[model samples]
Target: MVLCHDEIDAVNDMQNLVAAPSLRVTTVQQSSHTTLLLCSAYNFYPQQIQMTWLQNGEEVTSDVISTDVLSDGNIYYQIHSYLEHKPKPGEQISCMVEHVSLSEPLVQVWDPHPPRPLTERVKIAVGTFFLVVGLTALVVGIIKNKKRTAALCTVMHENLVAAPSLRVTTVQQSSHTTLLLCSAYNFYPQQIQMTWLQNGEEVTSDVISTDVLSDGNMYYQIHSYLEHKPKPGEQISCMVEHVSLSEPLVQVWVYFHCFDTGGVLLRVNIGALYLQSKVYRIGQLYMISKHSHEQSERGEGVEVVQNEPFEDPEHGEGQFTEKRIYLNNKLPSWARAVVPRIFYVTEKAWNYYPYTITEYTCSFLPKFSIHIETKYEDNKGTNDHIFGSEPREEETEVCVVDIAYDEVPERHYKESEDLRHFKSKKTERGLLPEGWMDTQDPIMCSYKLVTVKFEVWGLQTRVEQFVHKVIRDVLLLGHRQAFAWIDEWIDMTMEEVREYERATQEATNQKIGSFPPAISITETALPINVRNGPNSAPSTPLSTEAPDFLSVPKERPRKKSAPETLTLPDPGRRDSIFKLPSFFSWNSSPQPE
Candidate 1:
C-alpha cells in the first residue's frame, strides 16, 4: 500500500529524513598571494539546503561561490561552495550548513582534507561481479528454459566483463616489413592471459607481454606485442583468457594486405541538434584514419563563412546547420581521384558516433553562440531588407542536384510540466511550500525533426536537425545505420553511388506521401530556390578535396593548418569497448575455438 505524504515524512523524520550533508573544506594554493578554499557538501538527501561561510565567526559573503544543488535522481543532492582568500596567519575560517531535518547547523572548521588520492593506487573490480550475477540469474531461471537462459547468460558474461578486448593494430613499417601490434583493455578479474595465435595454434616465441595495468577503476588490462613481417594469406589472432567468460575471447585480425584499392579519406560534418536556436555558424572538421581503430586522430576546428542575416524562425519551422568534416589520413594523390565521399543528412544526435565524443575530440556542447536572428527567403530583392550588406557569392552552397525537405515529429511529454506536477503533489502535503509553483508557464513538448535530403554529386546526402537537452537527448542516441553507411561509402565511386542514391531518394520520396517535393531543381544561372531559409556553404574539409563535380569547394585549402588530431587507444586515455552502459553488449562474439 502507498503511504500518505504525512506518513512518509513522519517516517523520514524518525529516520532523520535524510543524511546531513558531510562538509569538507580543502584549500588550493592558487599562487604565492592567495589560497582558494573549496567547501564541498555531499551524501545529502532532499536537496533543499543552505550552506554558508564564516571568517573568524562572522558571516562571510564576498568571494563565495556555490554550485546549484545537483541531484542524482534518488532524492539525493551533492553540492560544492568555494571561497578565495589570502591566508593571513591565525585567521580562522569555517563552513556551515543548514538542512531542513537538522536541529543545529553542523559547523566544520577549516581543515584541509588530504589531496584526492591518485587514480594509480585504486584497485577496481570489473565485470567479475556482474558475470557472477548473470550466472546466478541463469541458474535461477534454468528450469524455465535452460538453453535460452544459458545463451543469455553467456552473452551477458561476454558483454559485462569479457576478456580484455584485443585490438590488433598494424601499420606498414616499410614496403618489406610491418609492425603488428595488439592492444587489449576494458577487462576484469586481473588474472588475464594474452598470447598471439597464428592460424589456430599459439605462437610462444617472438612475443612480448607487459605487466597488467590498472585503469584504477578495478579493471586491469595489458598489451601483448608481436613484431613480424608476414607471409601472404596468413591469419593472425590476439587471443585472451579471463575469468569473465566460459571460454577464452579471441579477436581475429585479417591483414588489410596487398591493397588493391587506393587509400581513402573520410570527411565528417559535426554538429548537435541542440544548436537550432542560433545563427548559422560553420562546423568543425577533423583528420581521422578511415580504417577502424587507427591511432593518431585530431580535430581541426575551422570555421566556415556565415550566411546573410536572417530573422527568428516562424512556428513549426526549424534552422538547420550543415558541417562537413573529413575522416582519413593524408592520401596519395591517386586516392583523391576516386574519393568515396559519404553525406548523411538525417537528424541523428551527436552522441551516436563513437569517435565523435571522445576526450581527444570535441565532445561537450556545440561551438557557436546561441543567437537566433535569421530569416531566409528565395527572392533576390528580399536580401536588402534583411542584411545591411549584400550577400557574398562565397557564402552560398550550391546543391547541384534535387533537394527534398521533410519534418519528422518527435513527441515527448513536457518535462518541466512533469517535474512541476510532481512538486505540486509534494507541496500539497506540506513538503515544499507553495512559493515554488509558477502558474504562468504554458506546457508544451510537440517538436519536429527538421530534415533535408539532397544529392551531392552522386552521394545521397541528407541533413537532419532537432533540438535536445542532455538526459532526454541521450535516450535518442543511435549510430549503427549511419556509421555503416559511412563505412560503405569508403568503397564507392561517384557514378555507382548516384545509382544507389537514386533508389534511396526514390524511397524517401515515397515516404513524403502526397506532399510535393519540398525542393525543386532547374537549370538556370545564379537562381537560388530556398523553400527554407538560412542555408550556406560548409567549411573546407580537412583531407578530401571537392570532387569538382556537383558542389563547389567552400574555401581554398588554408596555408596554415591545425596540427593532426590523434586517436589514443591507451586505456588510461579512452573509454574503449566498455563505453556502452553497464549491461549493453556489442555483437563481438569470438569465433569458436
Candidate 2:
C-alpha cells in the first residue's frame, strides 16, 4: 500500500539514520598546513564502511594521510585524514564513504582555486566602470521607489519587533487535561498588549493581571489561564499588539494529543515563525499531553503513591548534653559572723608580731618534752606581768632575757603520760616554773600557762633536732601588712617612673625647635627704655613692617581742663597794672645814639 505524505514523513523521521565521511583537505600558506578532518555518521556500522579521498577522480597515495574506521553498532562513525600539501590548480579533493543498502556513497568535496593575475591599470579601469554604473542604477532605484520602500520596510521591521516568541512550562497534568504555564520574554514595551485567541476570536474574560517591567525601559510579561483538552491539529494562538508597530505580530501555537497508558491525552506543540520576513526574538515553552491508550486497551489504570517519612540521627533524643552545678546554700550564719573577726585579728598579729614580743623562751627537756614561752613584753609594758616578771627599767632591757633552748631526749616517749611525768619532774626540780605543764590538757589555766611554753619548745626542737625547720616571722602585724602596702607603692612608683621616662624619650626624639622656646623673664628684658612709669615698653610686634591705614592707631579724645580760679581784689580798691620785665636793650641803644 502507498502511504500518505504525512505517514511517509513520519516514517522517514523514524529512520533515525545519517552518515557523513571524514574529508581531509590541507591548505598551506607556504609554511603552514591545516589539521585532519573529523566526521560523524548515525545508524551505521564502521566494519561495513569504506573511507577514501579522491583527487581528480584518482585514489590518493601514501603522501595523503587517512585514519582507521571508528564506530559502534549503531549508524554512527568518525574518522580523520590529512592532505600533505595545497592542491594544484583545478584539483578536486573529495571524501567518500560506502555503506550497505546505499546506491551511492556519501561524498564531500573541497575544490581549490589558483590566484588570478591582472595588470594594475586594467584593474583600475574595470573598478571605475562598475562604480559609475552601480551608482547610476542605485540613484534611479531610489528615485523610482523611495516612499514605497521606506513604508514597506518600516512596516516589516515593526511587525518583526512585535512578533511574540512563546514558551510553555508544563507544571502538572490530570486525567482530563494537561496543565501548562506559558511565559514570554524579551518583549518590547510597545508590543505588551497580549490576548489569547481561541479559534479566530479574542479571549478576554479569563485574563490574569499583567506584570510590567520594573526597569524604566519598555518591556512587559503577561500570563493567561487556559483549560482545554487539545486534539491533533488543533490551532491556538497568542497574539500581541503595539500602536508603534505598523502591523500586529501573531504567534500561532499548534496543539497535538498523544496517548499513554498512565496519563490523559492532551498535548500542545509550538514552533517559531517569522513575520514580514524579518528576524524576531521568540521564546517557546511546550507542554506535551500524554494519552492512556495502552492502559485503556488493556483495561488497566495507573496510581500515584506518597513517600514515607524519614528520621534524622542528628535530632535524636539521647544526645550528649552539658551539665550545670547549682549551689543550695550560702555561707553559714556562724561562719559569716566569725570569719571576718578572725581574719582581722590574724591579719593584725601578722603585722605587729616582732615589735609586740620583745622576749621569747623555748626549752626542750628529757622524754621529748618541749616548752615555749613567748613573753610579749610590750614596749609600753602592758603584758609584762604575763611573763611573771617586773616591768623593765630601760628600753634596752626589755629584750635582755630573750632565750631559746632545745634538748633532744635520748629516747622519744610513746605516750602523753610519760611526757607528763617528765614535765612534772622538771617542774619540781626548779628547771621549770610550778605553773609550767605539758600542753596536752583541756583546762583553760593549763593552756594559758603552759601552752605558750610548749609551743616555744616545739619550735626550738624542730629547728635543732628534726630534719625540717621552717620559720617565718614578721616584726609586727602592721609591719607584715606594710609589705603588701609597700608592694603597691612600688608598683605605682615604677609606673610613675616609666611615664616620666616616656615623656623624656619623646622630648629627646623630637626635632629641635619643633616647638617655640619658652619665654624666660631674663630673656624678655627690654633693651629700649621709655618714660612711662613702672610699666616697660611692649615687646616687638610679630610683623616687621608698619601697619596699613586701616590698622593704624587712632587718637584718644582730650580731657577738658578745669577753669582757672579767680580772686577778687580787696574791698573796692583799684587794681594796679603790673608789667613783667623784658629786656630794655632796644630803648637803651636809641638813647646812646
What's each prediction's TM-score?
A: 0.25, 0.17
lDDT of 1 by residue, 52-109 (tens): 7887887764445455665543446667676656777788899999987689997888
Top model by TM-score, which number? 1
Candidate 1 local distance difference test against the native: 0.36
After superposition, the stretches of candidate 2 with alpha carbons farther than 4 Å from their true spots are 1-170, 180-182, 215-218, 263-593
Q: How many backbone clashes does candidate 2 have?
A: 30
lDDT (tens digit, per residue) of candidate 2 on 1-593? 44544456766764664443433443333223322232333345334676666667765432333334444323355444433344466767776767764678877776454357688999999999999999999999999878765654433234334334444323111223332334454565434676667676886542332333312223444544343444444555566565544666555543322222211111111010111101100000000001111111111111111101111133211101011111112223533442232110000000011111111111111111111122222122223244343433221110100000111122311232121122222113112221122111111110011111111211222222121110101111111122112222222332243333234323332311122232111112222242111121111111122223312123421111110010111111111101100100000000000
Local distance difference test, candidate 2: 0.28
The C-alpha stretches of model 1 lying farther than 4 A from their native spots are 1-16, 28-36, 46-99, 102-593
